[model samples]
Each structure stands twice: as C-alpha cells, then as structure tokens.
Target chain A: MQYERPKSLMDAASLLAGAKGSAYALAGGTDLLVIMKNDDFDAELVVDIKSIEGLDEIRETSEAYTVGAAVSCAALGESTMLKEAWPGVVEAANLIGSTQIQGRCTVAGNLCNASPAADSVPALVAAGAKAIIVGPNGNRTIPVEEIPVAPGKTSLEKGEIVEAIQLDKRAPQSGDAYLRFIPRTEMDIAVVGVAVSLSLDDKGLVTSARVALGAVAPTVLLVEPAAEAIIGTKLDDAALERLADVCSAACQPIDDKRGTIEFRKKVSGVLARRAARIAFDRAGGK
Target chain B: MSAIAVSTTINGDEVEFLCQAEETLLDVLRERLGLTGAKEGCGTGDCGACSVMVDGRLVCACLVLGAEAEGRSIETIEGMANGDELHPLQTKFLEHAALQCGVCTPGFLVAAKALLDANPDPTEEEIRFWLAGNLCRCTGYDKIVRAVQDAAQELRGS
Candidate 1:
C-alpha cells in the first residue's frame, strides 16, 4: 500500500485514475481506516486530498454556501453564518457520530459512504443541496440525491471526487429541520430519519417544501408526493395528515433487528409530522 | 509497503517517526513511540478509548492513519499534566473515585479536558453529552460527571 498526499485536485485525481489495485481517497479516515482494518479489505493506494487548497474551507457567497469536501462536521457547527442559514443541514451533519467522530468526519464522506441510514444525506436532500464534482474530464454539479445509487455505492466515476456540497441561499420565511428515531440517545444509527424544508408565505401557507426520508430504502429518498402534500396549505391537521400519509406510503424498508418494515413506515409518518411542525415553526409560521 | 517518515509535533515537542501506510496513529503511539496513554478499546471510532487531539481537535487515534499525522500537532493524555503536577481533572478524578479498572481513565481525561477547554462552564447535561462518546462500563457515569464538574470549578478558581 502507498499513501500520497497530493496538494492539487488534478494530482489526486490522476493518482486515483492511475492506481493499479484498489484505491481510495482519504479525507477524514474515520471510515476508511475502519474499513482498512477489516480482514477482507484490500487497498493498494490512498490519495489524501486534505493537502489540496480550498478543500477545507466553508465559503459563503451571495448565491450559495459551499462546504469543502474535507471540511469537518465540527467546523460546520461552528460556522455561525452557515448554521444560521441552514441549521438542519448542520445538525444532521453533526449528528453523524460523537464529538471525536465529528471532529474527523465530513459530509462528503457521509454522502460517499452511500449508507441508506446516513444521518446527513436526508437533510441535504431535503435542503435541495448540490454536490460539486471534479474529475479528469472537468467539473460538474449534480443534486445530492443523484449521487447514491445503492446501499454501499456512489455514482462517482473512478477518477471523480466531490469537491464540495453547495446549498443555495435561503429566501425569507424559510426553515429546515431533521429528526431521526434511534433506540439509544446517542452513538447509534438511525432507524428512521426525516428532514423537512419549507418556506411560508405571509398567510402562513407553505409556499414551497421538500421532504426526504432515510433508513427506509436502499438510498435516501426524496418523496415529491410528500412535499406536494403541504404545498399550499398552512400545515394544518389535514395538510400534515396528508404529508404523513405520503411519507408512510413512500417507505420500502427491509426488516432488520433494529426495526421491522411496518414499524419504519409507521415511524416515518410520525417523524415527518413532527419535523414538518418544527420546520413550520422555524419558518415564522403560527 | 514502504515506510513513511513523518515529522510532526507531539505534546509540544518535535518528533520524527517511521510508520507503514496502513499503521494507525494509535499503533504508532503505543508500539513505536512508547506513548501508550491512548488505548485501543474497539479499534473503531465507536468507542473513544483511543481519543486524542490532532491539530487541537478531538478525534479517535485508531481512526487516523499514521501517515496522515505528518505535519500535524497531537495532544495525548501524556501531555495533560506538567512536569511533576497533575492536571486538575486528574486530581479531581482521583479525589472523586472516577476510575474502577483505570483502562478508560486516559480517554475520559483527554475527552473531558477538551470539553472544558472549549466551554469553561458546561452544564451537567452538556458535560454528559460531551463525554457520551467515551464509555465507562465498570464505573457508573455519575462519579465521572461529578469529577468533571469539580475539575471545571477548580480550574475556574471559584
């Protein structure tokens, strides 16, 4: 095995593209190191991209906020401007692991790990986030939901790397929130996760919204019907009920020791209602 | 695999070591550098027994590769005390009987010190949440929490 800390994105991409055996890009190493320790793991090259400039910064602009791929979750929680703008995304990213893990984990890593139960992907999807990718062919941007194709795989090409996750600036009366059900208080994976982002009009009616669910499918799901259920309503009981029903109907979960499929479907609705309520309140609604 | 020569700072001293690309910082610290303060409880990030500070941020040493420690500053439990005096958290732990088998003491102390360094006056709930990653099976967390509170108060000199 060989480790190369490349100072440039192209250099890192080239290294990964030219590797003979199994290769990986090491950002935080929280996941890679754990996987490397497995008996069946076979890794030949690790390209450390932390040495790349601007890859560890959280850049805010008039249009959007760009969180570098190597940026730690701890830094995201500490960014006052970013937190105030998108609290749900920050909270979801921070919920990945403990303080120690948060200090090392990255949202890009969480997305790339491609786990259906990843804490941050649902929130990012609900927030309508986009990932900026850099590859040998050049740069391209894609929706966060489009990156994950399966449980443990991503759509990223062999030489492509996600440089950052971009979130557009929020309009007035906009708020987002993420909630998950876990057996324990902390240090456990999500059983069912829900994230809701909504914007309210002057009349307290939801003008726009996006709903996402996790741990209930092979990949994080963006349920359009769930979002459309509350589009023009004030999130009253009927609107919320429709939203919950849509969320519950969207679940295609597997029965595991953590939860049964029926339990996941039931909780998805419950969490959607609760999360939408929180998002409604945050959006300055009554 | 070829050994990577890494030059980094540990406990405020410049240090140089040779390690394999696959070797973890915990392995290097315990096996090579003779700094066994950080224990390998799970060899995974789930348990914080191998907690340490890389570049002043708390992280699990077992989850970080030795090669990645190049040019970074690390703070382990060995650096928690001065030449002959123990840190307040250590003293408070001894006074409050915060340890049972003493295997997790180093990790707990390191993690608690990080919490105090960031927030001088953390509420009880905050302290518990901050130390949630470091598990203590033998001793219930009540004594450990009390010791951290006492240490924080002593450090604040009130």
Candidate 2:
C-alpha cells in the first residue's frame, strides 16, 4: 500500500482516479484505519486530504457555513458560532464517540461511511445540509441525503471526494435538535435516532420544519409527512401526536440485538415527539 | 515493504522514523521508537488505552497512521512527568491507590491530564464522562476518579 497527502483537490482526485487497486480518501482515519487494520483488508492507496489548506477550517459567510471535510468533531464543538447557530448538528457530531474519537472523527467521514446509525447524518439531513463534491470531472453540490445509497455504500463516483459540508444560514426563530437512544449513557451506537429542525412565525406557528430518522431504515430517512404534521401548527399535543404517528409509520426497521423492530418503531415516534418539542422550545415557541 | 520517512516532534523532542503507510502511530511508538507507554488495549479506537495527544488534540494512537505524523507534535504517557519528579496527577494517583494492574494507569493518567488541561475544575460527572473511553478492567475507577479530583484541586492550589 502507498500513502499520498495531496495538497490540492485536483491532485487528490487524480491520484484516486489513477490508482490501480482499491483507493480510499483518508479524512480522520477513525473508521478507515480500523478497517485497514483488519486481516482481510486490501487497499492499494490512501490519499490523505488533511494537508489541503483550509480543509480543516469552518468558513462562515453571510449566507451559510462551509465545514471542511477534514474538520474534526472536537473542532466543531469548539466553534461557538456554529454551536449557537446549529446546536443540533454540533451536539450530534460531538456524540459520535468518546472525547478521543471526537478529537479525530470528521462529519464528512461519517457521511461517507454511510452508517444508518451515524449520529450526525440525521441532524445534518434535518438541517438541510449540502455536500460539496470534488472529482476529476468537476465540482458539484448535492443534498446530504443523496450521498448515502445503502447501508455501507455512498453515491460518490470514482475519484470523487466530499470537499466540505455546507449548512445554510437559518432564519430567525429557527432551532434544531438531535436525540438518540442507546442502552448505555454513552459510548454506544444508537438504537433509534431522531432529529428535528423547525422555524416558527411570530404567532408560534411552525413556518417550516424537517424531521429525520436514523437507525430505522437502510439509510437515514427524511419524513416529510412528519414534518408536515407540525407545519402551520403550534405543536400542540394533537400535532405532536400526529408527528409521532407519522414517524412511527415511516419506519422500516429490522430486529437486531440493540432493539426489536417493534421497539425501534415505537421509540422512533417517542424520540421524534421529544426532539420536536426541544426544537420548538429552542425556536422560542410557547 | 516500502517505508515512508517521517519527521515529527514527540514529548518535546525532534524525532524521525521510517514506517509503512498503514502502520499506526501506536505501532510506531511501541515497536519503532520504544515508547511503549501507550499500550494497545484495542487496535480499534474504542479502547482508549492507546490515548495520546496529537497537535494538542487527544486521540487514540491506534487510529492515526504513522505516516500522517509528519511535522506534527505528539504527547504520550512518557511525557506526563517532568524528569524525576512526578506530575500532580501521578502523585495523586499514587496517593489514592488508583491502580491494581498497571496496564491502564498510563492511559488513565494521559486522559486525565488532557481533561485537566482543558477544564481545570471538572465535576465528578464530567470526570466520569471524560474517562469513559479509558476502561479499567480491574474496576479501580472510583479511586482513579478520586485521584483525578485530588490532582485537579492540588494543581489549582486550593
């Protein structure tokens, strides 16, 4: 195996495009290195993208925030501006692993790894995040939900790298929150995860909202019906109940050791209701 | 095997070594440079036994490639103490009898130091949460937590 730290996106793309065998783009290496160390792992090249200038930065602008692919979760937590703006995204990223893992893990990697239970994806999806992709062909931007096609696969083509994740500047009275259920308090994968992002009008009616569920399907799900249940309403008990029912109905979960199918379906509703309440409160709802 | 030459700073000393692309920093530290203070409890990042600080961020050495350490600074368990004198955390650990088997001591100490460096006054909940990644199989965590608390107080000089 060979390693190359390319300082340019084009160079990284070309390196991956030209590789004769399996090639991987290394962001944090928290997930990559684990698989690389496996006895049966076979990889011919690793292109480390950390050397690229500004790839580790969180660039904030008037319209949105551009989080570089190499930005660590720890760095995300440290960014007070990001935390204040998108607390759900920041908290979800911080909850990926322990402090040690957070120091090295990247949200871009989490998205690329395509784990249905990835703690950050549901929040990012609910926040309507976009992924900036750089490839040998050209650069393109796509919705975060479109990147993951299956349990362990991504929609990225050969030689394509996710350069950064872009989150839009939220409007006034906007808030988002992410919640996951695990048997343990920390350091365990989510049994069921839910994220809710909403914006309320002066009358406390939800102007816009998004609800995303993780660990209940092959990929993280954005339930429009669930979002619709709360839109134009003040998220009263009836509206929240409708939102929960929509979330529960949308789940296509499997029975695993972490949770039974019934349990996941039921808890998905519970968590969606709870997360929506938190997001509503954060948005200054009554 | 083709080996990559890397120049890095470890424990305030300039060091250079040859390592493969896939060799982890923990492997390079323990096998090449003879810095075995960072043990490999689990080659995966779950076990914090290989915890170390790279460029001031605490991470598992087992998850970082040695070739990626070029021009980076690392702090390991070997650097926790200054010369013959033990650090406050170390002294407190000894005073609190924080070890039954010594394998996890280095990791716990390194992780604790990182916590103290970031937050001088950590609550018990914070301490427990911070040290959750570093598992002590001997179940000596209560003493370890006490040692860290004592060390924090002593370091603060209150």
Candidate 3:
C-alpha cells in the first residue's frame, strides 16, 4: 500500500483530494489497524497526517478549548486545564481502553470511528462539543451529535478530516461525569455508558442538564426528556428517579454478548442516575 | 509506495533507517534494528509485551507506526543496563524472583523503568496502576510488584 506523510494541512487535503482509490487518514492507527487486520477494510493508500505540525496542540482561548484531532488520549487525560474545565471530557478520554491504548488512541479517531460503544462520544455530546472539519471545500464546524449518523458510520465526506474538537470556553457553574458499565475493568468495551453535565443555580437547583447514553443504540443518544426531567428541579431522589426512568425508556438496546437488552436498559438507568449524582456533587450541590 | 525515513535515538544510539509504509515500531525494532528486546505477545494493544518508551511516554510498540518514531528517542529493555551493571529495576527483578517464564520480563522491566523515571517514589497502588498495561502470566504479579517497590527504594538510596 502507498503511504503519504503530508507536513501541512493543505498538503494532506490535496493528497486526499487527489487520491483515486481507497485511502484512509492515519491518526493514531489504534482503530484503523484493527479494522485492517480483520479483513474488514482494504485501503490502497494510507495518508499519515501526524507529521503535520500544530495538529497535536491543545489550546484554550478566550472563546473555546480547541483540541487537535491528532492529540492522544493520554495527552487529554493529563491536561490539567481539560480536567478542570471539562471534567466529563477528561473522564471520557481516560475511559478509552487503557494507558497503553490511550498513548496512541486519538479523540478524533474515537469520534471518527463512530462506535456505538465509544466512551468519548456521549461525554462530548453532553458537553456540546463541535468538530472542526477541514477539506478542500474549506473549514467548517459541525456539532458532535451530527458527526455520527449511525454505528460505524460518520457524516464526514471523502477528503474531509476532523481538525479539532471545540468546546465552549465558559466554565459552567456545573460539574460533569462519565460512567460506564463494563464486564471487565481494564480492557473491555462498555455495555452501557452514561455521561451527565448539570448546571446548578445558587440555591442548589439544577438550572440545566444534559444526559447522553452510549452502547444502548446505534448512535450515542442525547436523552433530552431525561435531562429535562431533572432541570429546574432540586435533583433530589424523586427527580433522579424520573430522570432514570426517562433514560431507561430512551434506549433501544439490542441483545449482544456483552449484555442483554433488558440488562442494558436497566444498567443504563442506574448509570445515568449514578453519573448524574456525581455531576451534581461536582456542581456543588447539597 | 512511499518509504518513510525515520531518524531516532534507539538505546542511546542515534540511528536512521527507512521503514516500509505499513511497518509498525515492533516490526522495525525486531526485524530491521535487531532490537528484539520488545516482544510482540499480541499484535493488538491488549498485551503489553511490546512495551517501549517513545519520547518519554510508555506505549505499546505494536500500536505505533515506525514512521511515528521519527525524531523521537526510544528506550527498550535492551537499553536498561549500563554494560554489565544492570539497572536497579533489573537487579531487583532478578533478586526478587519477579519472573518465572521470562517472556514478560522485558516488557515489565521497560514499564517499571518508565514508572521509576516518572515517579521515583510511587505507592503500591500507583505501581499497580502504572504497571496495569504490562501483564505477567506466570508470576501472579505479586513478586513483580515487590520487585518494582524494591527497585524504587534502591534507586532512591543511590
């Protein structure tokens, strides 16, 4: 197979645009290699964009936190600013595989892979993350929720690559957390994952909330009704129960080896409640 | 196919080589450079037998492309000792009887070196967490954990 290492974004884009047959962008190669080995994918050419300088940066500006597509999960987990500003984001990155996998796995790859069980997608969706897509057509921002249309499918067109993930700069008077239920601890995919972000008013009432669930459907789902169940409430046991019920009802999980549909639905509710509780605590709730 | 030119410091020696487009670091280290200290127990990242340090970061060699190591410094199990004198971790592993089969020893040594280099004084829990990537099938990891602790103490005393 032909391998192309482009040193500039435009160069990479031009290479992608000029490619004739099957070609794929090599970010960290954590996921791509596995797919390639399984005989599930065949690529005539592989473009290594990692040599492009400035693509591995994690920059926080007055407006938003922009994390490059090539930034590894280990880098994200170790970023103190990211942990403080977007705790859920940090937690999501940390939850991907293990330290060894994280050393080479990129957040962009995780998003681009578009696995229903991707640990970072729900958290990013909950945080209202946006993808900066770059191509010959120019750069544009797409919502994280819109990036994945189905399991193992992405909205990215040919010659398009994710530049970075952008999150709002405003540190909400809120807390966020991600929790997943896996059969094994160290190296296992999530059976059900839940990410919650809650903004609390001064009086300890939840002013706004976002609840996202993973592994329970074809795409990482944002349960708006579940979030609305807790927003504007004190987030006490009753509100949490209502929210859990909504989350359980929202999922359309299928029975798989990892878990049964009934188990996933039940665990989804439990995880949603638990993550919401942690988020509420982090938001300085009583 | 474009051959990628990689120039890096391996085992304290500055070297340059051309790697095939699809070659992984594990393949280059084992086949091209003949630094077979890093073993590929599993081509996937699950098994840590192919652990190595790439620019001060402990990573699975199998997961990283050879081209990714360009301009980076790498330390393998072969680089641990200074001539005959073994590194503190290596000595401790020997003294503590950390390995039974010796297949996972190299990876454990490289991973322990990384941990000690980062935190000279790490708690047992920290050691366990840091070494979680490296797995030992023969030695239930109790002796390995003790060896790492002893190595930390010895390195700190020196």
The DockQ-based CAPRI class assigned to model 3 is medium
lDDT tens digits by residue: candidate 3, A156-245: 887889989998864557988999999866677899999999899988889988999999999999999988999988778899899889
Q: Taking the tens digit of each residue's C-alpha lDDT, what string does model 2 give over A53-77?
A: 8999999999999999999999999
DockQ values per model: 0.86, 0.82, 0.61
lDDT, residue A271, candidate 1 = 98
Provide fnat values for all models in the order shown: 0.82, 0.79, 0.50
Model 2 pairs whose backbones collide: none
What value of lDDT does candidate 1 attain over all alpha carbons? 0.94
DockQ measured for candidate 2:
0.82
Worst 10 residues of 1 chain A by lDDT: A28-37
Q: For residues A114-138, what per-residue lDDT tens digits would candidate 1 score against the true structure?
A: 9999999999999999999999888
Please give the distance, in angstroms, between residue B122's alpha carbon in candidate 1 and its true position after superposition: 0.6
Better of 2 and 3 by TM-score: 2
In order of DockQ, best first, we have 1, 2, 3
Provide the lDDT at A182 for model 3.
Answer: 92
Chain B TM-score of every predicted model: 0.99, 0.98, 0.96
Report the lDDT of model 1 for residue B108: 94
On DockQ, the leading prediction is 1
